[model samples]
Target: MISSTLIFQSEMFSDWIIYNDETHGEYLVTVDHSEDTCYCTCPDFQYRKQTEKFGGAKLDDNEHHCKHIRKVIQDGCS
Candidate 1:
């Protein structure tokens, strides 16, 4: 879960930003602006979201965004 008080700092890259979350022992969150994607190297991201087997069906929009991604957007992204 994303905390209302958690703050993140990001290191800018050419196409993505590396978000550093201090609340979780400086965990890194990757935010890809070009692809409008976000990923975290956390257990939650791996177990919950990434484990989904889409099979032959199209993925739902709600399935893509995680708490890390939401934090990045909440920090300041239009």
Candidate 2:
């Protein structure tokens, strides 16, 4: 079950900033629910076309959900 707290703490859910630490550097990450995916400013997303193919796995953890999204649900529920 998705927790309401997770929704409250998510930058994606709250219109805050989201970023990813990459090999090259840090890049902004954006979540697109309509498409059920995330876009990062990193080279992996920009040049390789890996983002579209592996976006879901990259975001999901053991719970089959992204950490950011999970945080939002937890925070929102709390």
lDDT of 1 by residue, 1-78 (tens): 343333343443111233444554334455444444455565666566653352111122336555655565566542
TM-score of each: 0.47, 0.35
Go through the candidates in order and give the C-alpha RMSD of each one to the true structure. 7.1, 8.5
Native-referenced Cα lDDT, model 2: 0.39
Best by lDDT: 1
Model 2, 1-78: lDDT tens per residue? 222211223533232233333422333445554444544444544554333464532333324434434443344321
Give the clash count for model 1: 0
lDDT for residue 30 in candidate 2, whole number 0-100: 52
Residue 42 deviation, candidate 2, in Å? 0.6
Q: Alpha-carbon error at 56 in model 1, in Å?
A: 19
